[model samples]
Target chain A: MSKHTSMALRRPSRLSPDRLRVVVPILALLAMLVATGFLQPRVMSYFGFTLLLRYSLPLLFATMAQLCILVVGDIDLGIGPFVSLVNCIVASWLADQPWLCGIALVGAIFAYAAMGAFIQYRRLPSIVVTLGFSFIWLGAALLVRPTPGGTVPDWLIAATGFRTPLVPMPALLAIVVAFIAHHLIMRTAYGTVLRGIGSNAAAVERAGWSLLVGRALLYGAAGFCGVLAGLTLSGLNTTGDPWVGAQYTLLSIAGAIIGGAEFSGGIVSPIGAVFGAMIMLLSSSLLSFLNISTDWQLSLQGGLLTLVLALRTLSVWVGK
Target chain B: MKQIKFASASALALLMALGCHAAKADDASALKDTSKSGIALSNSYAGNTWRQQMLRVWQAAAQQAIDGHIIAKTKIVNADASAPQQASQIENLILEGWNSIVLDAASPTALNGSIEDACKQGITVVVFDSLATAPCAYKVAYDYVEAGRIPARFIVQQLHGKGNVLVVRGMPGTQVDVDEFQGAQEVFKENPGIKVVGTVNGQWTESVANKEVAGILPSLPKVDAVIGQGGDSVGTYQAFKAAGRPIPLITLGTRQEELALWEKLDKATPGGYATEASSSVPGVSSIAFWVAQQIVAGRKVPNVVKVSLLQISKADLATWLKVTPVGAVASPVYSKEWTIDLLKSIAANTAPPPSPGPTQNK
Candidate 1:
């Protein structure tokens, strides 16, 4: 009981990098579930685990991608539209041509990365550049296949959409991606530089590491995630709409923050992002299960974000 | 003297006959060259296929019209779904003296002032697919609410007035989503048996739709069918499929491909975009035609009107496709002459184009 209360009430000293991340997002997810339960207890049973997995995967991928930017101490307001653009690419261009879809997928990610590079290299504010990129992508998407209607191949649909003997393909994909990301991020010299740059880019520059490359690469990786989601999602849905991209930009940011990518710097983890996404997905799943109005969903998302930040603060206090 | 007079008179008479023939030929050529580039279609964005189709059908109509006709030039601007971008582009065109602006506003409300300004400045603005918050111009749009209600009605029928159903929505604040959601509720009200088990904001993204739909599937074990808004419908179908529901789906935005799928599933595709490539054709052409009509009349068109009726059920889908009049050239029966002939035939002493076909409800 003490351990439960202690863990809930405060963060422990000597926290490991992996452990701190797991704790905070879990706490956040729990807090969300508790708060949601409080708001409407029926949300507990109403939201099944499968529902949680489905809703979180997109945001989960998005958050990890967004985290790549935040860890490098940059903001990507365009993550949402970037995903939208890629989704539009696969939706509009790849629907008819199955074999060429992979090539298009590569092209789309490169396009997103190039846009990110332009911002980082030009020393432009990422926020502004990503905003511009959003418009560019939206237009490009529309240009390729105007209006939102197309046929996705059925076999691709079955392969990506199915949940197997307890694990869905999308959720499994998210797990595999997260694990691979965890390994790659830890090993790369760029990852270390990214953390340092986030802490103090000037000092890292003095040490002769170009923050531009690091920033671009991080943003580039973020773009790749967007593309993956884009292509996978293309196979996942009936049709892709370019306008659909507008929603996830903010969602990725929210999920990353919840995952413990400190807005200031010196903190981020893919594992935590996974948990944050799970919590978020769980909350929405419950909302739908409880049969709540759509208005409440928005309000709850806002409220839940506020609560997560509060828990974050509480984590600091508990650590003390 | 006699010979000279005879030769001179014969030559003069021949010259006169040639002159009259030249005048007749010129008149015939004038009537023959019916195509003109008078219309300027300024689309706000090429963000969706429906809008794309609107642009396509409209453009094809104008292009295939007889030379020097009321249908004139086409300038397509993809605003990238940015309200400011769309507004600015329209404003620029208006400033550049393009008077006939046929627009598909990205945000129905956000584009109001820009459209109204275009109106005040004497640009004939016809909004297609989406409507403004306030009536700014001629809006040829589908029943915005019907876009939502038709699917709702179908599901109600499918579920036999009773079963758990899920709703996947588009962008929450957008006018289309709001109108469609409310429209859905209106139909849902009739069939109390069809209880809306859950509604999730997919935000019109497939990945998000898949996630949201997947999340809810575990809780409501009885959900029979998924109904989604325009962009989000496909996502719900995906999510349900992913979750192994194997339940049927009803989605918005039915193009021919979607039609094929619906038929394959033995489910109704509803009134989807029979008009392929909406942006370059229907939307651009509508703007082109309306603007030309207004410009040729030498009047600032007042209260522009637009029309897009919901093409519903597999039953009505064929008629909708046949009468929808996709642009100038299909392999089967598409010619400027044929379109002109059809429009003229359908005209009740009215403008040739948009002459409602036999299947046209209005």
Candidate 2:
């Protein structure tokens, strides 16, 4: 609690990176809100919030999965397929045999954790290993369901599809997720060791923290988040496509980066990551609403991301 | 000198007649040797239910041909949506000595070189569905532009060409979407009163269409009609139902869900709501198979045969739905005889290509 209070009191001079991480994403999100209000006034309604944030659950989960790895100074290239595999499993088996699906999900998490251990033990490049694992996950998903047709369990759908009277379900979910992840990654002592290991592994090692165990936990947490994300997505659509989450791999990385998590630095804020994911998703909808051509829309999105990232870099340099 | 010239002219005419008879005999022999004819399918992608149904139709047709001794064997190689891979697959099929290669190309131009190479090797290349643009290949694709026009025109007629319309488009920048959109736009242009209120990209999938339509439903004014490409009506219907809005006249696709909804609506709503469903049925691949058989039998086939979209009216919805299983695709049932007749008519240049026009719902 003292640590949380101190974090809130930290000035820009003391914690510039933490503050700058969320600045651009917040600004971009605000700009989109303004644009939406002007371009389409009805999106300001409660229904509009539900519509805008309906498909964002999967994205938010993917961001959390990626955030876990970024905190440990590694990346999960297989996050897309990992989420896709979970969706496939949930769509086909979970609704029928919840116990079996639960066991399989646990197995998948173990696999991810084992992958982390293998990488740490063998000193292999995580990028190559995870890239290889992505295919394995995709192949598994395809083998389970060739084409995208399966019914999500009624309970899962009901939970995801439920809307509060005024507050959209996604905002409520995001708050819950941010709060939980914040405590797990920021408030906990293990989190401090995780961040400490990321910045200076030797210092953490000298302090008697096992790097292998830490990596395994982080990867395990990532797997759990991925499953949650996949289930939420499947719940949202009440169907599964093996290839639906392919875009999420890059989006997750970009969201984490945009949220203030650097590649090598142990700079990740849970709330910032959520906002970053929202901003990334909002831009896609914003472009469509603006009546941009499909060919130019992707380029425009890339340009917008580049602009925000450049802003973040400039601010950091100036603050220093 | 006049008598000599006349005699020579008669003799030359006699020789020409004999040459024609010899060519006829050659074609007869080729037809008799149908057991030696082999047709191979080069598929670009088999990822969706439509492609699955297409493969089934092709297999059933190929099996029939094999049983009738029209073709010796059939081989199929799916490239999993890769253009270069499909091209190479076609190349390999040519090398394997197929009499004709029926292809569903990934792109109009990417497979041109491979298709031309096959044609050069004395193979009849029949491109269908997503067709290749090579002159050397015979294209047997449905006019997707016409497919789009049928729905737009239906909506215009139903709404009396004056109403707010919402366009639920397919994946952005896709050829199918572009052609369909252009056709709809052409109809809308002709009728100035039919105002397009808003357009949303449905991504050619039900869930996407549902989500996008649901998202924009609040922002849109009271839509009198909806113009959609195939695979979207179910989503559009679902969106309107969720919003508790009076369902407008929607263009249905091939999905069983869409057909089921159409059936339900036909019974529930008075005067059947003036709705119609249209699409290029996946079983049209059987038409491609029949065309391949004709080319292999030494029939002089045309460079292109355009198939029209199947528009199932509200009254005829049950007939289509009867054959379409629950959760399955609504594909046309093309019998072997029907395919052969279609192929023969097209080969003989008797069946004129369908001109793009306003499709009559009746």
Taking the true A–B contacts (Cα pairs closer than 8 Å), what share appears in each candidate? 0.00, 0.00
Alpha carbon lDDT of each predicted model:
0.60, 0.79
TM-score of each: 0.45, 0.51
Q: What is the interface RMSD of each candidate, in Å?
A: 18.0, 18.6
Off by over 4 Å in 2: A1-124, A128-320, B1-32, B335-362
Give a tens-digit lDDT track for model 2, residues B1-362: 99999999999999999999889966554444577778888887777778878888898888887898868988767755644335545644544567889999776654665677678879988989888778989888788888878888888888887999999999875578889899999999999999999999998788999999999999999999988887888888899999999998888886788888877887899766567778887777888988778777766766887777776765566776777777667776565456555656666767743322221210
Write candidate 1's Cα lDDT for B61-105 as tens digits: 555553445454555556556443355455445444454676666
lDDT of 1 at A83: 63
C-alpha lDDT of residue B2 in model 2:
100
Cα lDDT for residue B155, model 2?
84
Global fold similarity of model 1 (TM-score): 0.45
The TM-score obtained for chain B by all candidates, in the order given, is 0.65, 0.85
